[model samples]
Target: MEITFKANKNINQEQLLKLYNDVEWYAYTNDMPQLQQALLQSLDVISAWDQEVLVGLIRVVGDGLTIVYVQDILVLNAYQNRGIASQLMEQMMTKYTHVRQKVLLTEEAPDVRHFYEKNDFESCDKGSLVAFAKFG
Candidate 1:
């Protein structure tokens, strides 16, 4: 499949919902309006498309100079293992090459950890730093 990537593209609610639901991300799919608004307000968003279908996406939120937080990176189930996520990440990294800190928090899964590590992101515990978060 010839996948195309777009930055800060105009995405409708139906497209977002379908992509999120394809990956079983119920939390986002459960609140369509909030998810749509969040994407709209994010600092940057890179999306992968197969023709007109939204197959993958990566979203970042931060000041763009000192730090950038990778808030989300996901590809549809069928689209996984095909380098779509990596391409999306590469675009984000290339866009913020000058940023000192690029951070992301994700579930403690082996594949997830491997993906980030392969993309040159070291875990907080592996370095001389630590991370903390409190979800409401």
Candidate 2:
């Protein structure tokens, strides 16, 4: 498939919900309006489209300087393992090259860790640092 990458593209709720569901992110799927608002408010968004179909996406929320948190990066199940996630990340890294802190919190899974490690992420627990998070 010929995939085109775009930044801050016009994304609708239907497409966003479907993509999230494809990746089995149940929390985001629970409330469509909240998810839509979050996507709209994100500081940076990069999405991959196979024509009109949004097959993957990466969302970031933070000021352009000092800290930029990578809130979400996902590829549709059928499109996973095809380097789509990497491309999304590559775009995010290049766009926020000036940002000091590039952070992301994800579920603890071996594959998840491996993926981030491939993108040059070091675990705070394994490094000279500590990290914390509070969920609602």
TM-score of each: 0.96, 0.95
Q: Give the runs in model 2 whose Cα sits over 4 Å from its true position.
A: none
User: Which residue ranges in model 1 land beyond 4 Å of their true spot?
Assistant: none
Pairs with steric clashes in candidate 1: none
Give me the displacement of residue 43 in model 1, in angstroms: 0.3
Each candidate: what lDDT? Answer: 0.92, 0.90
Tens-digit lDDT string for candidate 2 (22-82): 8889899899888878988999899999999999999999998999999999999899899
Q: How well is each residue in 1-136 modelled by candidate 1, as lDDT tens digits?
A: 9999998646988989888988788999899989988998999999999999899999999999999999989999888999999999999999999999999999887598889999999999886999999999
Model 2 residue 128 distance off true place after TM-score fit, in angstroms: 0.4
By lDDT, the best candidate is 1
